[model samples]
Target: MVYCGPLSKACLPCRRRKLRCDLRTDACTQCTRAQLTCSGYRDTTALRFRHETNAVQQRVTARKSTTTIPRSPPLSIYCQARDIFYHNYVFGPSKPFEFLLSVYSQTSKDVHLSRSVDAVALAYLNAQRPSGSAELEARRSYVSALQYTSRALQEPHLAKQDSTILAILLLDLYEKITTRAPAFHGAWATHLDGALALVKLRGDEQFIEPSIRGMLIRLSTNVLISCVTSRRPVLDDLVSLRHTIAAHSLTPPDPKWRESDLVIEFAKLRHNIDTRVLADENEVTFALIELDSKFLELSRQVPPTWQYVTIQVATKSIHHYESHHHIHPAEHVCQMWNTFRATRILLNELVRSRCMDRQGRVNAGSGFQGIHERATRAIKQMATDICASLPQYIHGPSTFDLTGSPSASSDLGSGTFPAGRPDPRYHLPCYRLIYPLFVAAQSSVVPPSLSKWVVDQLRFMADYHAIKNAMTVANLLESGQRTDVGKVYAMLGSYAFVC
Candidate 1:
């Protein structure tokens, strides 16, 4: 056996297999002889010395002391912006941040995606600090992102790449977060259109990568929400993709809520309702009835651990509000229940609206009257349930002393509460409740008192959380109440619903 002094120059496959190789210019002899592909040699210059002889080490230290080795250039503004984007926008509970980070890290050489990250990061910073310099920088980054994206799109192969799609999605998020005015709402939609086009071009087979799957799912979710809010027809491709994902179990059930599946089911049903005019009325009705049955089945499938059964405690106060429930259910349980109730409201509303008489009155003999009544009752009950759940959300445990005792003192002030007790307005779950509250507030059957309470909660969210959307929802609900036009979708207009 001819001995090679070192295996460092051998082809990757030969080195891995511990085989001798004649390291040719292109393919190695050993790899060819073995009928294996040679992956080529690694860069020898990139190898680092972990340990060295004393004399060599001394010489190296002396050289370093005598002449400073040029350090790599500091990270550019764009690079810094990308980091900020990951930390501030990308790394979150809802996002698969680690997987996305890995994907981004692997594709660091992709200029389109890098520029998009910079653009989104700059836009996010500008949104936080709306200054001339920040705006200018953001604009520059945005232009760069657009240019790179356009270049990528021009290439037939590159346009369908995951990196290209991600760039477009990032741009969409940038437009959504930075564009404050209603006039620029269509800007996000345009990017969404571009992303959808790319997704169509790539097809389902390209989504084998987990990161790609996650991104496509998020994009579909955004599109679904937009369709629901705008009363637009859901795309056939999106529906197909959703079913594919569900079938493949690409989106795993969340342990906390397990609501993703239910949400998708509801979205499909809602889409059917939205485009029902195009289908046979009887077929649509039958489909909806079947969907309702499925929903009922799903309701029963809720994990026993997730189910919140309230136990009422007697209190001294005369008011019913003085009675407290002892159950301290998970925040996700409340969120899931609210989602389920909201979906029911939408389904029942569709049935009720379809069964309405020419004068906009529900037909008593159409069997829709009973459905409407049940939905209305459910909405009110859900609203009350949400109101009751407030204590759990606010206090972290359902230990509210409704009898006006000293235990209630912890909830009194705004930000002055001790370490463990934060203001309810600033609680994370409060922000999440906007959709459910809005749904409840829009119900004609909700009592004025309950409606006012919902509005007050929204106001708190707007005031404390600085959520402009909360204020918008509050105003819309108020307008709807005054005008007797309580349709949420009608009032939403250009404002995209996030939740």
Candidate 2:
């Protein structure tokens, strides 16, 4: 066993456990009793990496400038989707969940910010100004953050004082400042505060850990806030019920709110609160759904047998934000969820043998493949659970539900959706939906063999539904763009694709 500065890699007995090597040695007395054979130490390499990475990172201090080094990871086709998600963490999607969740992991690498694969994060971040056309400004910031996140994933590093995920959180907060996704300014501000508070709990648990849970808390908080702004009483009630529903307190025979009341109250509130807030929340949810879908599609789309170019092209795609991560309130979040889950399974089963899922390691068929498999299983479970739970929020009279109404969707202006008053159920715990997905590999397990993700892709192929029309002409320009043409569209002429 080797002695590291403050951390020890392993004892003699532990070394043998590459297949459960009971790493124990005379140096590690406890390991010996356990019949373990501790072997060589390796944790030092990470520490050394941390020291050098920091000295290198010191060039951009938080106070001086929060700029990060940009990076484009070596993506296989399957992981190509990650390229977009990585950047989206920094710039796209009015609200970023996985991006925020991965914050703690940012410090370990340079690509999180300083580096750039395509000058995307830098271009977008530089575009951020305190005051500007609200929509355009927000879109700019979202684009920058997305690029930054992807680069970070590509270039893995370890910061001395912070965990990689924590760094990701802080960076996410920084990116959130750019979100104008309807009503997320307040949401971003509130989430930043919560993210800061999670540092103390970073080590207390194993399952998803408290810091991870704290991240989930911020996401859930964002969801609750969005519902409140959704101008939909039922959605609001669902938002409120989120935490309570978890306790099973809201599911009684009589329940806190019943169906007829749910319907009537939603109808009453449809003409009240400012639509901007509702529209914004609608937009935020849409971004999240898109992020989730993209993640599933890419994760699966990148075949284990996928070509390097396929992955490269996809990686480049992450840097390409076709437009703002905007979403329509009328879109259905649940409709495509199962399809995503099934697709994730199909893709993962094919590529499970490849992903590193860890930092600074080659994606080869080794012990890490097990972790990759776990990641896929995690996505499947998460998608399944989130989809199952989301309908509770939708079933209520919130404006998105057209089940019993005239025309199903009302064309209220920019923000209004069923323009209604606030209600109770809209506050349900929707954020709890993705909570356990990113836990330490130590605790995550493959679903019991019985759990299967079976979806009839054919079932989702129809009209395809409007779902979310987030792409704006500006997105078209920013995607591979140069000039801002109109207040709405960035560039009107030639595309990088054709060239």
Q: Model 1, residue 498: displacement in angstroms? A: 5.0
| lDDT tens readout by residue for model 2, 193-278 | 34333333333332244334434444343333233333333333334333333333323322112222222332233323234333
Query: Could you give me the TM-score of model 2 versus the true structure?
Result: 0.19
Alpha-carbon lDDT, every model? 0.60, 0.33
Best candidate per lDDT, number? Answer: 1
Q: Ten residues in a row with the worst lDDT in model 1?
A: 490-499
Total residue pair clashes for candidate 1? 0
TM-score of each: 0.65, 0.19
Model 1, runs deviating above 4 Å: 1-90, 96-98, 125-136, 179-194, 200-205, 250-290, 304-336, 359-362, 366-369, 388-429, 481-499
**Highest TM-score: which candidate?**
1
lDDT of 1 by residue, 1-499 (tens): 2222332767788878888878798699888888888898766544433334676779988988999679999876655566655653356333423345755763588888887777777765554435566567878878998899899989988888878877877776666556544322365655666677778777668667666667777777666655555444556766776666665564556532245555555566666655664376546555655666666677787777667666464442211222443243455566667667676666655655665678988776656767656656655665666665554444333334434232554442232333442453233445566766777668776788777767766775566555566788888777764432223433332122132
Error of 1 at 340 (Å): 2.7
Model 2 poorest ten-residue lDDT run: 490-499
Off by over 4 Å in 2: 1-209, 213-336, 340-400, 404-499
